[model samples]
Target: MRMGLVYGCAAEDMVTGLTIQCKRWKPVYYNPTKSAFLGVSPTTLDQHLVQYKRWSEGLFQIFLSKYCPKIYGHGKISFGAQIGYCLFLLWAPVALPTLYYVVIPALSLLHGVPLFPKVFGLWFLPYAYAFFAKTAYCLIEDLSSGNTLNGWWNSQRMWVIR
Candidate 1:
């Protein structure tokens, strides 16, 4: 049977690639000394956000549909591949928790309600550690990937926006 790119998806490339992988075909990656392809990136924040939203929604749609990696990919793909697909596909649903974390804390603070333990409390230690560790890890990862501090900050901002 002949295989082609899947249609009717905002992220057709991603859907097609996932489908191909599920068909037990291994993909090849070739990295040469020179650039192989050039593409234009979204120039403005609006354009970037729009593109991101579309891609994320498409991934979420797949997750909700029968094509979910954990569902359709079961037995067809390796465990690690299914996990990797799930991580990317779950991006949109992650926004709900992010929203709750951002908005609830602020609203609680505004109402003089403490949503977390005091800084000196034992429970605070875990929260503090998690926050600092995640921040540090993200910073290190961004820097290691050749991104500047500003770039890391911008990525964090974009994460919240998305």
Candidate 2:
């Protein structure tokens, strides 16, 4: 009951929440009929990117530090919780592969090097399906959350930038 947020972390809330969870505390989500909290969001793209960059860096730091869920929460928390933390914490590293995927293909095309199968090849079906499925899922999720189509498009742009 006397617990306070751990200091020296960029994402103190996340670090504190993980610490509380590791201490065997079960968190509850309360969604009232009305909003319980109101917060301001970044009003510009630069602000949004800076905020996300800080978040990603902090999460990555946690992934590399002793506070890493897989390491610190080994026997204290459930495997699902560890996996969830790893998923969020791994975002910064994930950007590496994303960067390669975005850039390598263009460079290969410029060099006339064939990196992938033809558009009509049988092996291309899986890639096509994965891309479209993820896109549709994201669109449905955004729309379900009450975001406009323009907002969804902007989100897609931000995903690549982040």
Candidate 3:
């Protein structure tokens, strides 16, 4: 949970009507997080939050449903694993372009090619650093607090069972 800081997106702060899209994969009954930009309304933020939670729950069910898990897999796979893969795939549009613009050029320059990127990697360094640093910090916190996924681990140390 400590790593949640980096793992989760920013929380809604105000009731600003947000214009959004319908999730491509969601069922009609599970319609969630779809929004439109409207003037400040007290319900806007709450609605958005409700919508996001709904979408998250829907996705959770879609990827983790008992009836559907056989297709998506369950014990061998797990919900988080599936979602992480999907999320990684989703980042491809931006990541691919970024990789092409940055890594490719850097490698080309290193190989003595004239085609060198303008070093946008430096621009993204802060964010990258912050992400890893926060993850590491949260991991340490979790370890110290003994509040890991499987509950308190250190509190149950393995003893030599005669």
TM-score, per-candidate, Cα-based? 0.76, 0.79, 0.22
Q: Name the candidate that leads on TM-score.
A: 2
Q: For model 2, how many clashes?
A: 0
Show pairs that collide, candidate 2. Answer: none
lDDT of 3 at 110: 85
Cα lDDT tens digits, model 2, 22-105, are: 987767766566776679878788899899999989999988999899999999889999999899899888888898988999
Decoy 2 TM-score against native: 0.79
Q: Would you list the C-alpha lDDT of every candidate in the order shown?
A: 0.86, 0.88, 0.42
Which segments of candidate 3 are over 4 A away from where they belong?
1-43, 66-162
> Candidate 1 lDDT, tens digit per residue, 45-94?
89999888888999989888888888989998889989999899998888
lDDT of 3 by residue, 1-162 (tens): 111111122221110101011112222223246645546632454575565555444444443333233343344455774445445323324345666776887887789886623447666777677878976776677677646844333323311110
> What are the clashing pairs of model 1?
none
What number of clashing residue pairs does each candidate have, in the order they appear? Answer: 0, 0, 3
